[model samples]
Target: MNSRYLTPLTIMSLAWLSACTPTRVSNQVSIDSPAQWQHAANAQSAETADLKTWWQGFNDPLLNELIDKALAANHDLKIATARVREANAMVTGAEAALYPSLDFSLSGGREKRIDRIVGVPSGQGIKLITPTADAVSGGLAARWEIDLFGGRHLEAEAAAAQAEGSQEGLHAAQVGLLAQVATNYLELRGVQQRTGILQRNIELQRERLRTLQVFLKAGLANEADMVRQQTLLQSTEATLPVLTNAKQNLIHRLGVLLGEPPENLENRLAGVGPLPKATPTMPNLLPSDLLVQRPDLRLAQSEVSAAAASLGSARADLYPKLVVSASGGVGALAVGGFPSLAESVYALGSGLSAPIFNAGRIRAHIAAADARLDQVAANYELTFLLALEDVENAFVAHRSARDRFSQLTEAEGSAEKAYRLVDAMYQRGAGDYLVVLDAQRSKLAVSDERAKAETAVSVAMVSLYRAFGGGWTIHSGIDKASIR
Candidate 1:
């Protein structure tokens, strides 16, 4: 190579490279964290509860078992896990760009040709001759595209960040799945409790109907009274089917969540059980904790990082690329009636390619990457705001549910007492059927409300823990004591 011809081109390439030095794109977003939660009053007890195992506080073995089954088998969680693995593989591929690649090849061929001899010795005229040739070749070639502007490194960084985001996505899926299973389970138990209340009310109403028949035989009660009592009993009976259907639906949903057929758990969960008890207790938590605990927020943060790195990688496209390649091999060839000839072949070369004109394609890509960076940053901020909303709403909902349940409990007891007293009076011919019916209706209504309220409290707690991102631990291991 002539120095004179290469000197100017090398200088120009260096100048371009100097101007294209890759810069790091920052993905940091501004977020103000509150020092304390707004609904701190709802959680008066300061005892640190391990949010990771918060469901254990319910003290229901069946509930814990269901959650375990869902975690092990849920389809959504498996999908998230696969995504994480894919992202990790992408990271590996991107990093591989930082190194060189080598390849080996071998080839062989034979050719034959027939020719007529125009001039022949010893008066031999137009003699025909056949000629054949053989060739063999083999080589090893290597190529490397040097990361002069750190473009490949940026790509690897982006891939790593995406892998992290996918991991957080898996965690988010786990958290949501656990919450769903717990919510449905609590609802199922609540329906069962309400059903039991209706059954008891029916029994009481049937006894009153028997007393009325006795009164009618003695000329104290009329056919209209008997008809009214029968109507109340039938109305209570009608409600049972609705509750039965609801319970069955919930069981089906739970079974699917656990990766089983819809009807698989019917026998297992058919027996009625008491609803999980609510403690209404939570550890002291601050808004800042969400940054570390909440998977969605973490996922958003990772997205911002990935977007920023992608922007940097795209910007590297504006610069020049340098590729170096080398090949070494041996070749052998032989002609008909001639000795074989063999030679060693080798080559070393390098090239520099700078983007000159592509109809603004590179610039468009850079602009798109910049736009994505901005989008992810904004999404990160929005995610934090939504996390705050979720926590605040869960706090209020859990507290309100607990309060409503307490009030309903007292009302149910009073209604039951009233119903018993009115029934006693009517049996003694001191009260009418209307009074008994009113008391019976009130008792059933209050009892049902209390059961639903109790379930609400449990479900609210589930929502609160989910908002806190409690059900998942980092694959690298998390500090359980600190996260509590």
Candidate 2:
């Protein structure tokens, strides 16, 4: 190389290096949130409990046990945890790309060659020559891609963000599973309560039927009235099986959620238990808190971060790349019976490649990356909005359910009083049979509604905790290995 030309080339290379400006995507996101929750205005003024173990507030030991088991054994949670591990491995791989690679190679071979001289003296006719050689070589080579524009670093950043997103996904799965287990358990207990109500009502109807039979035999009651009482008794009995089936199905679902067979929990849950009650007061939280509390929202933010890093990486592709490589080796050669000769060898080189022409291939990648960033940003905003919706909806549902349960409890007490009064009058032969029957029916209906109302309150509480991303903090140590 001539110094005259080398001077200009060196200057140009330095200029190129100086022109490589670091490009990065903005990761800051802002969301418009209300200062206070609209639905939380009328919430009860009680002490707020820890949202981490919100299920325990129901005071149901069985429910708490079931949730703990599900958290450790659920299949969906295991799968999500696996994904987190995989994403973490991908981060390591992307980071490795910024470092140099080294490899060692060894080879040995034998080569033979033969030559003939045809134009020698006529007396000699032809002269023949043969050469043989054995050669062995071994080397270590290394290559490194210089991070000129931070492209490799951006790739590692993208991978790290993805790993965080996957971790949030696992938390989301845990939240969902906990909610599912609680909802089903509450519903099952409610079903039992309703079944008990029906059974008691059937017995009352049976007693009434017997009384009517005796009255008819004594000519005090008509046969038609007795038959009507019989029909009511049988009708009440028919609904019992529906509740039975529902209870069985719920137990099966709970079993499956706990990673057990459908019938595994039937015996354990066979005994009827009272419906769980939710706390009257709601958790103390602000709208902005969801940014950190809700796993889905956090996951969405991570997605945006990963996408931004990816866009930056794509932009870096438009810049020139620098690779430095080196190799060192020893070679041995032997010819015929001659002593083997060994020589040391080494080499160092560098290459620079720029996208001089490709019909817009690099630009196309940048454009795609930009679009993905936009999409992820939009999704992040949407997730935040949806999280707000969840919390507000949960607030409304929980409050309304609690209120309904309170009102139904009052109604049930009054109905029971009325039934007792009517039954006493009928026993004294002063009240109509039809009125007695009506009173009994009202009491049963009110009791059944109250049971369902209680269940609704508990289910709503589970939803609220899920919206708040409860249960994840407590299970922070949870992982694929831990679960297994």
lDDT of each: 0.83, 0.83
lDDT tens readout by residue for model 1, 1-484? 8987785587457545634446568777777766677886633323223677778888889988999889889999989999999999999999898788999999999988555223333456554555578999999999878777868888888999999999999989988898899989999999989889888878878877888899999998999989988898899789889999999999999988999897778988988899876453464566777877888988988898899989988888888888878999999998766689999999988899999899999899999999999999889888988999999999899989989999999998999899999999999999987688779878888988999999898899889988888876645522223221
TM-score of each: 0.87, 0.87
Colliding residue pairs in candidate 1? none
* Number of the predicted model whose TM-score against the real structure is largest: 2
Tens digits of lDDT, candidate 2, 202-263? 88788788878888888998988888888878888989889999999999999989999977
Best by lDDT: 1
Worst 10 residues of 2 by lDDT: 475-484
Q: How many clashes in candidate 1?
A: 0
Cα miss at 459, model 2 (Å)? 1.2
| Candidate 2 lDDT (Cα, 0 to 1) | 0.83
